[model samples]
Each structure stands twice: as C-alpha cells, then as structure tokens.
Target: MNGRWAVGLVAGSGTPSERIAAELRRRIVAGELALGARVPSTRRITREWGVAMATATKVLNRLRDEGLVRAVPGVGTVVAGKPAPAAGRSREPQRVSPRASQRMAERMPEQAPEPASRREARPEAESTGARRVRAGGERDLTRERIVATALRVADQEGLTALSMRRVATDLGVATMSLYRHVPGKDDLLRLMMDVAFGEQPLPEPPASDWREGLETVARVQWRIYRRHPWLASTMSFTRPVLAPDAALHTERSIAVLAGRGLSWEEMAQASVALAAFVCGLAVHFEREAQAEQDSGLSAEEWMDRVEGEDHERLTADPERFPMFDAMNRGPEIDLGLEALFEFGMARMLDGIGLLIEQRGGEGGGLARGSANK
Candidate 1:
C-alpha cells in the first residue's frame, strides 16, 4: 500500500511480518495514516512488501486483533482509528472530526468491553482456539457463518491451514465465540464436509445409456473433488463420515444403473469402485498443492527437477528399459491427471459392460459370477 516500487524486494529476516506489522502500527499512531483510510490488501501487501500471502494475511490479522484495522463487509480491511495515545507518544486523546468519525463508525461496529467474569474464567487461547474466536464486540456470530468461513479457509488455503482461530480471525470475531456456534474442530469439519457436499448436489444424469449415465455421474464427482481438492483426502471408504449430501452421490450413481440388469452387489461394487478411483487420483491434487506451498515449487518444476536427474535420464536410455525409452520419446508420455482419470474410467466401464454381456444382460445369478466359470 505504500507505493508500487516495493514489489520485488520481499526478502526479510527473523519474522518480517512482525516488522511490517510494527511499521503499520506506527503509521496508524501518527495520524499520517488517517482514521477510516483504506489499508493495503493482503495481495497488495504480499506483492509490495515482497512477502508471502500468509505473511501478508498475518500482518492484517495482527492489526485486526489489536483493533487497529477492521473488516468492512463489502469494503475491506480499513484503518479502524488512531490507537489511544500511549505514554511518551502523546498526552491528549486523538481527536476525530464528526465526518471522519461517522465514516469510521460505518466501517466498524462499536466495541464492547468483555465482562470481567468471562474474561477471568476463560482458558488461554491455543492455536486450535485461535481461529474460532473474535475479540469482544460487534455481534453477528452464527453457526452458518462460522462453517462457511471455515470452508472458505479450507478451499483457499488448504485444510491443514484451516483452524478455528484462522476462521475467527477472518470473521473478525473472538476465537472462543466460534465454539458457541460449532462445538470443536471435529464438529467444524463435519459441518464443513456436509456443507461442501450439500452446496453442490449432483443433478440427475442425462445420458441415454447406463454406461454413459455412470460416466456422467462419475465425472460430476470428479469435478467436485477437483474443485475442492482437500475433499478427496478427507473421505474414507469404510465407516464413512455420515454426511447426507455426500450420500446423494452414491444414490444418484445407483439410480443411473436402474434397469441395467446389474444386481444389488454389482451396483454397490460399481459405485464404490468409481468413487475409489476418483478419490485416489484426486488426493494427488491436494498433495501437489501442499508440496508447492511447502517447497515453493510447482508440480511441473518439481517434476522437471526429477526428470533432469541421472536416474530419470537413465530410465529413458535405449540400452535399458526399451519400452520406457520408446514411450518417453513421444506425446503418449503425457501424465496429465485428467487423461489418467478418463483412461481408468474407460477400462472400468469396459469390464462392467463385459459382465453385463456375459450374464446375458440379466438372470443367471450374475452377481454370483458365471455358473460355468
């Protein structure tokens, strides 16, 4: 927010975020940064300060916690007001003109002091508790709001980065206040999972044939998993999470196979198989994203590093592993996840088709396998 020239110089030492935060605090205290003035956005801070997004977000969040900057729903993070003049800083109270006060008032809710009893009774805020509570004041805490915020955090920052404290920080509420709506992390996750699935219900399959219908259903699931990469990792095949919206996927899958001559076991097996395949591949999406965040290298960049290695080059040598060597020379070597998904899907459908045909499309205890075999 300072100026455009600071973009590339993001390098720093011991906790640069803290340094940036201190500087902003100073600016707010001085009146050089006016009350109700728009502050730098996290993205602007990241690019301008040469810091990571997390660092930038931390900067804003720290200011919010101190009641220096407040989130204005449709607007954004803005300077809350000059901090109360501290000792040695100034003797008099910082004055605000009526117009400036009104604008600032519109941007922020009035703050209320925490009740003495509750303040003394509360336990220390831990990392898990950090994301959930907003400091005392402003109102508007609801379970729906909390879960939605949690989902947003998971969607944008990955699930590992999501916590009650993080969500509360974004909501501009005390972390402890979130517990009033959602019980705990496990409960939050259950709510988040249900919301994610329920929010995007699968529409009825429009294909004429059963195989096409199955493909349609499977692709819908695949797309949903792709949209929320963290999703695939959270799911389990056995002892499922008991989410009703999520269960709709299986219901739809089975409904598509109605009158397809498949037995109950066959239908269930097919649904599980398709789900397993989609989820197995989709797990890589979150893993790859986490790898990028941790390593600061993209999937292509990491793979390029591998492919440039001696072992990788050795695998392509014609003298050894001839088929791999031959395959490496052409476009067929493409390893796009989408291509792999479709390839696996086609094969699974082919086997299912063969089962239907071999059993004469009905009867013969098809679910029990062929009598001759």
Candidate 2:
C-alpha cells in the first residue's frame, strides 16, 4: 500500500490504527486492492508502518468492522467482495456489553465514553472516568526512555537477564512497542553499549604522553565497567561491536601512539592489547559481583575462610616448591584486583616501552628478528 497517504492522515486521526485502517479502507473502496486480495496482516502492518502489535490488530479489526475485509481459513485476512458503504455513513451502532466495555476501558483509557443519548439507550456502554485515567501512559515513550530503561536493566541484572520484553515491562508498555523504537535486541544492545561508553568520556586534549594516554583510556574504561558491571562481557576482541563512542577510547589510544616512531601495525596492536587487557580484567567485575551476591560473602571474607587451610596445604610440601614458599615467607601479599590491575598495567606498559626502545634499534621493528615472523 502507498504509505504517503497515511502520513497526511496522521494529523487527522482518531488513533494510529484508525489512520491505517482508513488508508486500507480507501484501497478497498477504490478497488486499488482487488476483491479477494490479501490484506496486510498485523505483522506486515507493524513492519511497514512501525506500530505496535496492539495497534496493528486494531487496524485489522477496524477494517473488519467496516465490512471491507474477512478472514479466510488459511490464506489470511482478505478483501471482502462487498459494495462500499457511502462516504460519511457507517453501520448502525452496536450495543456494547458492560463487561466488554469495562475491558475496553482498561486497555484503551484514552477512549471517551459514547454520547449521553447513546449511553441512556445502552447504559452498559458507559465507562466511568475512562477519559481521565491513563490518557498519556505511553505519551513520553521515546527512544531515549527505552534505551535508558534497558541500560538500567542490564546494569542491575546483567546481560543474561536483559531482553526487549524485560525493558518494555519496566517501562509499562507492550513488548512489541519497543520494536517501533529499537529494531531488535541486538540493536538495543549496541545502543546500550554506546551509552555506557559515552557515560565517561576521554579527557579533552588527549594525555600528554602515549603512556599517559593509554593509562587514561584504560582507567576510564575500568571505571565504566565498574559502574556497569555487565558491560565488559559485551566487548569482543575478534568481533568488536562497532559502537562509535566505544571506538573513541581506541581512537585516543592510537592517536597518542602515533608519531612515536612505531610502525602502524605496532600502534594498532598496542592499542588493541591495552584495551583487551582492561576488558579481560573487567570481565571479572560482573562475575565477582554475581558471586558475592549469590554466596553472600565479599571477596575478602571468602578468602579469609579458606586462605589459611589452602596456604598450609600448599606450604606443607614447600620443599617441593621452594620458590613459592620463599615468596610467601614475607608478609601476606595484597591480591586485590585493584592492586593487580595497577601492577599488571605498569608491567605491560614497561614491556611496551621496551618494545619502543627496541624499535629504535638496527632493524626498526626487528631488532632481534622479523617482528612479523
């Protein structure tokens, strides 16, 4: 069907479904849609016009009410070969039962009651205060609202529990309505990731040195992962999610690595390596949080319960592993993730600095042998 006509009718509408039904009614009346022609199903209506399933169903029901269509056993709803009712005329009003009217009021609170004369004739159709309640329940539903709701769900429950339906429930809308805003769950996830990365932006005028720039990017990502524990698992090394905001972290890292007398390949590898390191460690953030919640014990407390026994068992055979015993002979070591991240980052940067020094040697990238092979 031509969708342009529906755009013009949007401002002249009763509801979204009514506008769509009017367009289809025009088609049936004008013979643009031939007799016995298949009418657009609810799925097609949603795909074509980007409306919720409830709205699409209403569209079909409106056409059926107008005697312009009928449902075939298996072929789907089709145009009924009936003469068109004259313009400005409609079928006689059907009396609605109180139970059905109540249900309608519950679902469609925006609908006003029938005229007082009609209600006097059929008191069952009267809906008490229906127009005053829930008139704008979904009026503020925007792409931003959907994305924000999904982000909160993922942050609190992890990616495994985050779904389009879950977000719609949180927003108190139909599940299919979310599809009108976001294409699907994958697209929603991409949006969520972009929002997460954009939350803490890289500083302006990039860090002074390459090391500082990388550290700044890494720490910023760490903080993001810490805030939204589920974000780390969404990151990938082989198949990177192409979120523009997330790429800014890499862009800043690579920019600082530029003009450092390093090869382009080396710069790329270093940038990815730094990001991968941060993400790799950050993966534990959600896992640890989940573990603590499930087991009702913090990391330190859990370790305290088993540390002595494990330590004694390992040291019991210290002679078989002298270096291990020698290292533990000193005061207890701090194995916190923060300390490990700091120490590992310093060591990794030290190694990268060594690579930079070696790159300045005889063979450029291959001071000892070919950097590639």
Q: Among these predicted structures, which one has the highest TM-score?
A: 1
Local distance difference test, candidate 2: 0.69
Question: What CA RMSD would you report for each candidate?
Answer: 11.6, 19.8
Residue pair clashes in candidate 2 = none
Error of 1 at 10 (Å): 22
Lowest lDDT 10-mer window, candidate 2? 123-132
Error of 1 at 74 (Å): 24
Tell me the whole-model lDDT of each prediction, alpha carbons only. 0.68, 0.69
Off by over 4 Å in 1: 1-138, 205-208, 310-312, 316-320, 362-373
- TM-score for each model: 0.61, 0.60
| Candidate 2 per-residue C-alpha lDDT over 217-282 given as tens digits, one digit per residue, 9 for 90 to 100 | 889998998888888888888998899999998889888877777888988898899889988899
Q: Give the TM-score of candidate 1.
A: 0.61
